[model samples]
Target chain A: MSAAPVLCFDLGGTRMRAALLAPDGTRLAAVEAPTPAREGVGAVLDGLCALALRCRDTGVAPQAAGLCAPGPLDAPGGRMLAPPTLLGWRDVPVSALLGERLGLPVLLENDANAAAVGEQLYGAGQGAGSLVFVTVSTGIGGGVIVDGHVLRGRGGLAGEIGHMKIAEHSTDCACGAQGCFEALASGTALGWRAARVMRARKDGTPPPSGRDVIEAARRGERLARRLVAEHGRWLGRGFANLLHLYAPDVLVMGGGLANGFDLLEPAIRAEIARSAMPSYRETPLLSAALGDAAGLVGMAHIVRQSLPDLGRERKLG
Target chain B: MSAAPVLCFDLGGTRMRAALLAPDGTRLAAVEAPTPAREGVGAVLDGLCALALRCRDTGVAPQAAGLCAPGPLDAPGGRMLAPPTLLGWRDVPVSALLGERLGLPVLLENDANAAAVGEQLYGAGQGAGSLVFVTVSTGIGGGVIVDGHVLRGRGGLAGEIGHMKIAEHSTDCACGAQGCFEALASGTALGWRAARVMRARKDGTPPPSGRDVIEAARRGERLARRLVAEHGRWLGRGFANLLHLYAPDVLVMGGGLANGFDLLEPAIRAEIARSAMPSYRETPLLSAALGDAAGLVGMAHIVRQSLPDLGRERKLG
Candidate 1:
């Protein structure tokens, strides 16, 4: 008999998504709800349990669950430690709380790390021995996979590539550091740069969103194109650093900014070619294939791996 | 019965040093010879074998050998791929050639990587689960140890930290890149910067070597002190990047410039504390304990691990 499905959750500050995935990683059912982040930890935990139950009630009883959320988190200990987007939540035992409510084992992972595992196992990075997965959204975030395992360094914080200092001097990051990669190249950074440019042009237009800039560039607006190119150049600089450090089989780009990967690929490639050592220049850079589903799929795999006995019990029954 | 000793070699452009190390990593006997690098691969290989035999003849027989040399190298394939320091040599199968001569199984690793393993297993980084080892010599190079195994990324070039671009604009590196860690922070870079300063002052003093600058700084010369501080600042920036990316248990410093580690430590620590995220700020920065013997000790361990059967055979005999 085939193994039972595993429940997976991608809990973001803005939304909470849950899915029941078949053993082969097919999403059999899913549910979504707005996160009660502003309503405190108790509300958030209760809401997650409700969402998970709604997905579990879809006629396929998941044997285990996995949760992927923003960090700084203790993945091994299953605790959240002050994720920026989730206001006022601190040291919450997310895995334990949700697990007790559902009476199943729940493994926890960083969202970007889940995406990396997802891509490596089922997306653009399939068959790769090692990869670097980067997500450029409100803030740049990433995960590193080495020899098929997520490189969770001391304190499970190994893949904080977004905070890597890319320039000697530049804008400040929310982390209070100057010249961080996220500060220079994230979607938020791109929009802020575009807004500054528009303001300097003495036009009465309101500040554009990151997506607005990408859309403008798609429509052949010269200013937007220039801004996007500059964004790609910063990303290339950061990617070159990643290549030098990891030399992964591939670099998988995801997140909202990656929607403009086609527009950004040329500049990114050109800068990496110019900045990276020749040996590292040939590493493939590709767009992530799993999209929003990556975290869910990755979580499902993590759950199965962590609770193999549950899958065996289901098969035996 | 105790395990047999392993022969180890640290092959550099300037010297070839060989040693017989007891199973516990104690150096039993050693021999050194100048590398005939300019005379080409055949001459260098012959010199290495002669040195190895001399070290072996010192009353203990080694069952296998490990060699740590400058890279770009294919460590698993045991081939050197166009190392900059080794003149006129490319893709030489040094391990196969040496193993054939000595009648022993041989393992090869990049020099920095070997040092990293050595530090992690038996030196300053002893007991650390993960660490980054950096050598500041004529060039900057590094190795990453993740979960007790060296992180040899695609093509075995994972830890080329020296070539990591630290600045968006700066001096040129030998690798044809601008603003690399090596170009900014290596002993060679420090010397070059000092020489430029001296020339601009129109002083008739011949260009100072990197060692000269360090010695001058030791004596509290204001100009040399300032230069060394600048060098430390650059190293700090590069190290902050490493900390953010790897969050290693510790960072071990080695190579020629590390001799001045006491003087440089303050600036290096200041930069990292100022730049790295709070969680990573407490990682201990240490001077390499085994000194020049780190490579040999590391290679000895590698030899034992790679050829466990050899150790068993020696024990049985």
Candidate 2:
């Protein structure tokens, strides 16, 4: 293994995160910048290149670099095939472009898959033998780790948990599907519910934001509590499906909503217990340990595996 | 690899299957018999031994023997642990018992995992990088093949697909769960639906078996057709969930209902297309190529991996 740290970048729709990770999985330095994603793919690429160069100048000219972002993607080909959240980006050759710009081999992975790997290697799933990581964010995304290797399925595009049609009549998804888990459960869906409840309130209650709803639930807001419980039920239902299909040793929850896992976990666990096969009832579900850093760290881990010849590969640029 | 033939057995609750397989993947002989399962675990063991002795008497004593049955099991320790379908079979040291009786090493595998391994080596999943297998029979069972290995999860009980919650208000399952995929869409569930519809019929139609429902649907009986369609919808929804979670290269469907797959395929595929992530529309759902032979063949396949010293380890007993 290279002793030099791996530079990791997590590219989101609104934020660009950068980190330098040591060979022993330690984070040395990290920073974040606004991602002007609306400026299109070119601007995003430029931002990524600048971020890597900044990391290099700060004494972490990485042996390699890892990038994590949303999909529909070609992970093996290192291309983004028009992720729904990122507009005007289609078949972007991310890895090649970064490799050329930074003069270093770059590995790209689906953000959720990266986070799952990071958690499996260093977070809540550290001791678990097999795991399924679900991130219930604006939408749901999943990463499945079995026997230490992620199940990338056929084309490195595995683990898209949100689009699964768990509900027969919930709502239509942007993906043109009805009753998807994400359509029914995600943070965005929760926010939509909260807004609708506020609109229908005869007592003239103020509309709560997703964060506000979570906070109010904690503070004993009845409507907020009911809505969040509904979210938890949806989450639990999805988790039950996963437990049945994978029988994972652990189910780890990550992403923004996981911050209030204490509120969500009980309902999720109850659903899993009530829905999963008896033999699978013992599988533990835990909150992610790395928090926001998971994407960067997971990308770093993927980089080591994907770009094995990082330092030794003949540099073209 | 050993050139000697391996004896493989698939011990189901109702039937016993055996085969002699050469190392080159050719079957020398195949045999079947009634399982005698109702007589309890000891009778099952004696029946298995009798089948092995019959195989030996007919020609070659196997270099090793592999047995595939239901979960929960200890594959590493070769013990059967309280499988619901196998009454009174609790922590039976099957491998030890079989080895003692046959004077050869014995290997045990969960039937689903065995089927998955079978597919990877010789069935529809051959040459595929990853595959997920689901058997929609009286119950739902899942097996995952990632890269070239069967994903046994933490302890050999990974891939339990049938119990995933597909319906929010599905009936209680024998495993003491409600809303499970099995409770909503298994062959048994389909039968139940047919019976309920028949009871509600003004024309006084007889209640249908699962097979009868399939035949009636094929003949275009409206109620039967509707029942099949509903079952297909559930199957599709469940597959959509599985697709999002695993994104497998290919999904192989097996079990008794697979015979009517032609009747079920179109609706299932259509529902999946309607419910899945847009990018995953092209993922294939296929009928298993190995048929009922998968269990027996898979046993031989897993034995070759788990007990490397199968032919070499001779027992005087």
Which candidate gets the maximum TM-score versus the true structure?
1
Query: What is the per-residue lDDT of model 2 for residues B46-126, given as tens digits with 9 covering 90 to 100?
Result: 888887777777677567788888887898888998877777888899988887877778888889888887877799888
Global lDDT of model 1: 0.89
Q: Model 2 chain A — which ten-residue stretch has the worst lDDT? A: A308-317
Worst 10 residues of 1 chain A by lDDT: A308-317
| Candidate 1 lDDT over residue span A1-317, tens digit each | 23888888999878889999998889898889999878988888788888877886788887788899998999988899989998887888988888778877788899999999999999999999999999999998898999998998899989899988878777789889888999999999999999999899979999998889999999999999999999999999999999989989999999999899999999999999999978899999999999998999888887777786544543564
Model 2 lDDT tens row, A11-68: 8887898888898888787878899888988888888877776776777567788888
* Model 2 Cα interface RMS deviation (Å): 1.7
| TM values, all candidates | 0.95, 0.94
> After best superposition, candidate 2 residue B49: deviation in angstroms?
1.7
CAPRI accuracy category, model 1: medium
